[model samples]
Target chain A: MKVLPYFVILPLAGSFLVIFIDSVLKDRKVRDTVADILANVIMLTLFILTLTLFGQSCSYFVGGWRPPFGINFLLDGLSHLMLVAVNLIALLSGIFSINYMSQYTARRHYWALFLLMLTGMNGVLLSGDFFNLFVFLEIASVASYALVGFGTEAEELEASFKYMVMGAVASSLVLMAVAVLYSRFGILNMSYISAAMPGESFDWLLKFSLFLFITAFSIKGALVPFHAWLPDAHPSAPAPVSAMLSGVLIETIGIYALTRVIFNVFSYKSILLANLGVISMMVGVLLALGQTDIKRLLAYSSISQVGYIVLGLGLGTPLGIFGALFHLINHSIFKSLLFLNSGSVFYRLKTRDLNSMGGLNKVMPVTGATSLVASLSISGLPPFNGFFSKLIIIIACVQSGHPVLAVWAVIGSVLTLAYFMKVQKLAFFGKLKEINKEIKESPFFMSASVIILAALCLATSFILLPGVRNKILTPAVNAVLNPTNYRMMVYIK
Target chain B: MKREEKNRAPTTELNGMSEIVKTVCNWIAGFIFLFGCYITAYGHLTPGGGFAGGVILAASFILIVLSFGKDKISPLLPRKRAEMIEAAGGLIFIFTVWTAIYAGASFCGNFIFKKWSCANFKLLSAGFIPLLNIAIALKVMAGLFLVFFVLSITRVILEGEKLKMVKEE
Candidate 1:
C-alpha cells in the first residue's frame, strides 16, 4: 500500500477518533493521555513517511480514478520537504501541548481541533487540485480560529472574532477566484490547468482572478497591509498553538500556496514580484519595531521573516529560489523555537507583557537559554541556521543586481536582532523580579520541545552542505523552478 | 415554566393593531426567509448558494425577533432544539459532501445521482441541491435562533436582577 495518503488520512482519522473517545471518556485523565500519545505517534509516523518519500515522486488519485477527472494528491520534492517540516513541527507542538494544555478544561477538544488542524495542513501540502487546496485551507483556518478563541478570555475572544471575520472574507475571496478558474479552465486539477494554458486567452477575467487570488493569499499569509489579523490572532492562542501559527501555518498555506499558484498556474509575473516584495519587506519590519507584547512582537517579526522569503522568491533567480526555500525551512525551525520558547515564558510568568518581566534567566535556565539561542538564530547570527539562509538571501539579492533590496534585507535582519535583544534584556537578562521569584521552569515536555527546536535552529545550517542540499532543498527548488517538468511527469504517467 | 408567568402579562399587550402588524410582519419575514431557502437549495442550479441562503434565513429569524419579541419566539423554538437543529444542519452539509467520495467522485463534487444534468433544474429537480438548501436553512435558522435566544435571555436575567436590586435599595 502506498504510504503517502496516510499522512493526511491518519490525522483525519485521529481527529475523529479523539472526538469519539473523548465523548466516551468524559475528559478522563487516561483518555487525555491516550489521545496525546496517539497524536504524537501519528505525527511521528507521518514524519518517517515524509522522509521515505523524499526524492521519490508519487501521486494518488482519490477513489482510484485518474487525474484531470479525479482529485490528485501529488507528492514531489517540494511537498516532501513541506511534509517533513509540517509534521516535525506538529509532533513537537503535540509534545508541547501535553504540558501546556493541562491548565485548560477541555483537553480532548483541544486535541481534536489540533488533529483537525494537522489534517488540514497535511491535505494542503499534498493536494493537487485547486478546490481541494481551498477546502483544506478552510479546514485549517477554521480550526485555527477556534483554537485562537479556545481561551475564551476577553482578548482571546476579540482576537478570534477578528480572525474569523478576516479569515471568512479571505475564504470568500479565494472561493471567488477558484470559481473563476474552474469556469475558465473547466478543470480543477492544477497540472491540467497548466497543460491547457498555452492556447487559452489571458483575458481581463483571468487577470482579475489572479489579482483576487493574490489578495486573498496575501491576507492569509499576513503580508504587511493585509496583516492586521496576525498580531492579534497569533498571540492569543496557547503557546503551542502560537508556535504552530508562527512556525508553519502561515508559511505552508499562505506562502507555499501563493508561490505554487503564482508560479505554476498563472506563470510568474515580474510586476507582481517587485511591487509586492518591496512593499511587504519594508512594511513588515517597520511595524514589527513598534510592538511591546512579546508574542505580538514575535508575530510581527514573522511578517518580516516572510518578507525576506518573498523578496528572495521575487528575485526569480536559481540562487534566489534556492535561498527562498532555504530561508523557508530555516525560518520554520527557529521561529517555531522562538514561539515555543515564548510559550515557555508565558507558561511560567503567566503574562505575555514584556515590561512586566525582568531577569527570568536566574529562575528558568532552560527557557532563558533556549530563548537566547532562538533569538540569536532568528537575528541571523552566525553558527545558527538563520544566518546561512539570510546570508544566502542577501547574496541572491546582490547577485540579482538589486543592491537596494539586499540593503533592506540586511536592515531587516538588524531590526530583528534589535527587537529580540530588547526582549532578552527585559525578560531574561536583568535582575529577577520579587514577584517572579517563585516562578519555575515549564514541565519536562515543554522543555524537551524547546530544546529539540533550538537544536534544529543551530543544526539546520548543515543542510547547505552540497550533499544535504542536493538530498533535500534542491529537489524542492527544482520542483518550483521547473513547473513544466511537473506537468510532463503527471500527464505522461 | 415558572418564568412563563412573569412574561404572560406583557404578551397581552400584543393585541389589536399591534397584533395585526406583528402577524403581517411575521408573514413577510417568513416569506423572505423561505425565498432565501429556495435560493440556497437551488444554488447549484443558479447563482446564490449555501452561504447566501444561510444568511437570508438568519435575517428572517432576526426579523421575527424584532417584530414579536423573544418570549413569543422562544416558545416556538427553544434554545436546545435550535442548537440540535444547527448541529444537524452542519452534519447534513458534511454528509452531503462525503457522499461524493463514495460515488467515486472527489469530495464535494456535486455527484448526487451521477452526471451533471439540468433536467431537474426546478425546485425538486436538482438532486442534492435541494437537500443542500434545506441543510443550510436548518443551520442558518438554528444558528441565528441560538444567538438571539442567548442574547435575549442574558439581557433579561441581568436586567431583571438589576431592577430587583434597585427596588431593594
Candidate 2:
C-alpha cells in the first residue's frame, strides 16, 4: 500500500533516466538498447506490482499529509482494474516498440516520451483529486502530441496539431470544471467533494460543471461528435504509439476519469449517457466501414467500442457496470493486439493501405493468426473475451427494459463483424501481391507482443466464470454500485 | 534580405547582436541569475517560488543567447548538457522523494530537519522544501532553455528556406 507512489515514480524515473542515457552515451546502438531495456523493465515491474493489488484496496498519502490536505493515490477495485489494464498494455506496447521503432531516428527520445506517457497514465489512475487528475491528463496529452508527430512528416505534423488543438480545448474545459467544483464545494479531493455533494440540492454551477466534465471526457474518449481527431492522430503515430493511444490512453484519461467523476464524485445518472453511447456506436462503425487504411479502421472501431462501455455504465445497474468494466479490459487487450498486427504489416510492407496487402498469412503466420484472433474477439465471436462482455452488455440492456437498445447493440456487433471480415479477407486471405512476395514475419519482439495479447484475448474470457468473477469483476461492480463507499477512501488511512 | 546577407561570413557581424545589446546583457544577466537563485533558495518562505524563479533563470540564459548568439552559449551550456541537467533535475527530485523513505518517513515526507523549530525564519529551516524547490528550478530552467534553443534553431532553418524561395523566385 505504501508502494503506491512507485506507480508514478517508476515510469517518471525511467523517462528521465532514458533522457540522461541518451545525452550521455556516444554510441547510438548502446543508447537505444539502454533506453529500450530501461523502459521495458520499468513497465514490467509496474505491471507485476499492479498484479499484487488484485484484491486489496488502500490509500497512500503523499508527503504523509492526510487528505483533504494532501494528494493521495487511491487503490480501490476500480483503480486496480485500470492500473492493471494500463500497465499491462504499456508493457506490451514497449516490447512492440523495441522492434517497431528501429526505422525511426532518435529511438532513445521515443522511449523517454513513451515512458512519460506511462507515467501520466499511472498518475491519472492513482490520483485522488480533481487537480491532480487534470495535471496528469495534460502530461499524457502533451507527450502523446509529440509522439503522434514523432515521424516529423507533413501529415503527421498536421494530425498532431489537430489533436493538440482539440486536446487543449478538452484540457481547458476540464480545468474549468475542476475550478467550478472546487469553488462550489470548497474542496479538491474527490472524496471530500462527494461527501459534500449529497447535502445540497442540484445547483446551476454544479450542473454546468457536470456538463463540462461530460463534454471534456467525451472528447478525450473520442466519442462520435469529438472523434475527428482520433482517425488522423492514431494512424500518424508510430504503430506502438497508436496501440497505446487507442487501446489505453482514451480509456484512462477519457472514460475512466469520466466514470470517477460521475459515479464516484457526483453519483448522478442520466439517460443522456446511454443515448450518446448509442450514437457513437452507430456512427463510428459507419465511418469505419469505408476506410482502406488499416490503422484508421481500427481507430474508428475504438470509438464504437467505447460507446458500448459508456452505454453500459450509463445503465447504472450492477450487471451493466460489470459488463462495462469487463469490456473495457477486453477492448484494451484485443485493440492493442490488432494495432500491433497492423504495425507488423506496415513493418513488412511499408504501407498501411489494406488493398496493397494479400495472402499475408502465408508469409507471416504469427501476425496473421494473432490478427485473426483479435479480429474475431473484437467482432464478438463466441469463446473470445469480447463475446462475453458484449453479451453481458446486451443482457443487461434487456434486463433494464431497453430491449430496443439491446437490438441496436446487436446491430452494432454485426456491423463490427462486417468490417473486420472485410479487413481479414482483403488484407490476409487473397493471393499474395507481387510486391509482397518477399515479405516475412515481423521481428521476434513484435510478433511476441501480439501473440501474448492474442492469447490474453482468449484467456481473459475465463474471468466471466463464477469463481473468477467473484474475485475480480465483483469488486469493481460493487465499487461502481456504491459511490458512497468511495468517500471513505480519504478517511481510511 | 539579400542573398549575400543570407550567406554572410562567420564573424562577429554574423554571430551576435550589436555591442550595446551585448554590453547590457553582460551587465544584467548575472544579477538576474543571482536573483533567481535567491528566490529558489528562499522559495518556501516567499511568494516567488521555484516556477517563478526558474522562469527568471531561463530568461537570463535566453537574454544571453539573444545578445551573444549560439556560438557563445554552445561552448558553455550545449543543448545536450542542458538536456542532461533537465533529466538530472527530475532524477534528483525523485531521489529526494525516495530518500525520505530511507530516512524512516513516508515518501516525500519532510525527513530532513524535521526536528527544527518552524517558528524560526532561516535559510535551512525549511528542510526538504528548499531542496524540492531547487530541483524544480533546475528542471524548469533547463527545460525552458532547451525549448528556446530548439525554436531559435528552427527559425534559422526557416530563414534558410525563405532565402531559397527568394532565389527560386
Candidate 3:
C-alpha cells in the first residue's frame, strides 16, 4: 500500500531526471547511455514491484485522507492486471529503444517523454477518482502527441496534428462527462458515485454521461466510427512508440477505463459495446487488407484486435469476460511484438512499405523469425496465445447464445489470418530486393527485446491453464463481474 | 543631453516600443511581480493559488519581453536557465514529498505543521502548503515564460521561401 505512490513517483522523477542529466552532461553518447540505463532501471524496478502486487487489493489515500474527502489509489484485481501489462510493455519498449531511439536527435527527450507517458498510464491505472483519471489521461495523450511528431518531418507533424485534434475532442467529452457526473452526485470518487447511484431525478443525466464516456473512449480506442486519426497517428510514431500506443495505451485508457466506468461505477450494460466491437472488427480488418504500409496495416489490425477484446467483454458473461481479459493480455504481447518487428525492419531498411522489401529473412533472421511468431500468434494459429483467447471468445459467444455474433467473430479471425499471411508473404518470404543486399540485422537491444516478446507470445498461452487462470485471470474476471466489489475493496481498511 | 539620452535605454531594434511604454512597463512590472508573490504566499488562505500567481508572474516577465525585445530579455532569462529553474521546481516538490517519509508521515503528508503547530492564519501556519505552492509557482512561472519566449521568437513565414515553395507545389 505504501509503495503505490512510487508507481507514479519513480517514472515522474525519471522523466525530469533524464532531462536534467541531458542538460548537465557534455558528451552526447554518455548522456544517451545514462538516460537509457536510468529509464530501463526505473521500468525494471516498477515491473518487479508490480509482480509483488499480485493477489493484493487495497487502497492508498493520498495524504492519509479517507475517500469522499481525499483522492485515493486503488490497487485491486483490475488495476493489478493493468499495472502488469503497462509496466511489462514499458520495460520491453524501453529496452528496445536503447538502440532504436539513437536514430533520432535529442534522444534524451524521447526517454523523458517516454517516462512521462509511463507515469500517466500508471497514474490512470491507480487513480480512484474521475478527475484524476482525466488529468492522467491528458498527460499520456499529450506526451504521445508530442512523441508522434518527434521526427519533426512534415508528414509526422501533420499526423501529430490530426491525432491531437481527435484527442482534444475525446478529452473534451471526458471533461464534460466528469462535469455532468460531478454536478449530479457532487462527488468525483468512483466508489462514492457507485454507492450513490440509486437516486431518482439524475438517472437520465447519468445515462447521458455514460454515453459521453463511451464516445470518448471510442475515439481514444480508435473504434470504427471515430478511427480516422489512428491509422495516420499510429504509423507516424516511432516504432517503439507505435508499439506502446497500439499495444498498451488504447487498452489501458480506452478499454479498461470504459469497462471500469460501465461495469463498476454505473453497473450498466447495453448492446452498444457489442455493436461497436463488431463494426470495428469487420471494418478494421477490411481496411487493413488494402494497406501497403506495414505499420498502417498493424495499426488497423490493432483496432480489429481491440474489437475482439471489447466484443468478449460486451457479452456480459463470466466466460466472455474471462476471454476478454485473456485476449487483452495476449493482444498486448503480440501486437507490441509485431510493432517492434516493424520497427526493427524500419530501423534497418529505412522503410515501412511492404512492397519494397522481399526475403528479409535471409539477412535479418531474428526479425524475420520473431515477426513470424508474432504474425502467427496474431492470426490465432493453434499453439500460440492468440488462438486460445480467440477460441475462448468464440466459444463464450456461442455459449451465451450469440451464435451469429460468434460466426461474425470467426470470420473476423479468418480475415485476420488472411491479412497477416499477406504481410508475411510480401515483407519476408519472397526474393530479396536488388538494392537490399547491404541490409544487416537490427542492433542487439532491438533483437533481444523482440525475442523476449516473441517468447512471451508463446509463454502467455499458459495463462489458460487452470492454476494460472485461477490465480490471475479469475480475480480480474470477478472484478469485472461484480461492480459492487470495487467499493468494498476501496473501503477495506 | 547626449549623455542622458545614452543613459536612457537605447531604442534600438533590441529595445522595443516607445520610450513611454518601456518606462511604464519597467516601473509597473516589479509591482505586478510582487503582487504575484503575495498571491502565491497567501494561497492557503486565499482564492488565488500557485497556478494563478504563477501566471501573473509570467505575465510580468512577458511584459518585460514585449517592452524590451528578445535580444534584451534573452540574455537576462535564457531558455536554458528557465528550463533549469522549472526542473529544479519539480525536483523540490518531489523532495518535499519524499521528506514526509523521513518526517514519519505518509507520502505527501503534512510534515511541518503536524510536527509543530504554528499560529493559525499566518504565512507559516499551513504545513508545507506554502512550500508546495512556492515550488508550483516557480515551475509554472518558468514554464510559461519559456513557452511565451519560444512562441514569441518563432518566425512563421507566410511569404518569401514558403511562398516560393507553394508556387513550386
Candidate topping lDDT: 2
Ordered from best to worst lDDT, the candidate numbers read 2, 3, 1
DockQ of 3: 0.22
Clashing pairs in 2: none
Candidate 1, residues A327-365, lDDT tens digits: the string is: 898888888888888888887877888999999999999
* Candidate 2 error regions (>4 Å): A199-201, B1-14, B115-119, B155-169
Give the per-residue lDDT digits (tens) of candidate 3, residues A418-457: 9999999999999999899899999999999999999999
CAPRI-style grade of the A/B interface in model 1 = incorrect
- What TM-score would each prediction reach against the true structure? 0.78, 0.95, 0.94
Winner on lDDT (1 vs 2): 2
CAPRI level of candidate 3: incorrect
Give one digit per residue, the lDDT tens place, for model 2 in A1-493: 6779999889998999999989999987888898889899999999999888888878888888889879888888988898999999999999999988888877877888898899899999889999999999999999999999888766787899999999999999999999999888788999889888954467899999999999999999998799999999999999999999999999999999999999898889876898799999999999999999999999999999999999899888888899999999999999999999999999889899999898999999999999999999999998999999999999999999889889989999999999999999989998998878888899999988998999899999999889998888898888877878898877776
Per-model fnat list: 0.05, 0.60, 0.33
Residue pairs with backbone overlap in model 3? none
Error of 2 at A176 (Å): 1.0
| Local distance difference test values of all predictions, in order | 0.80, 0.89, 0.88
The residue pairs in collision within model 1 are: none
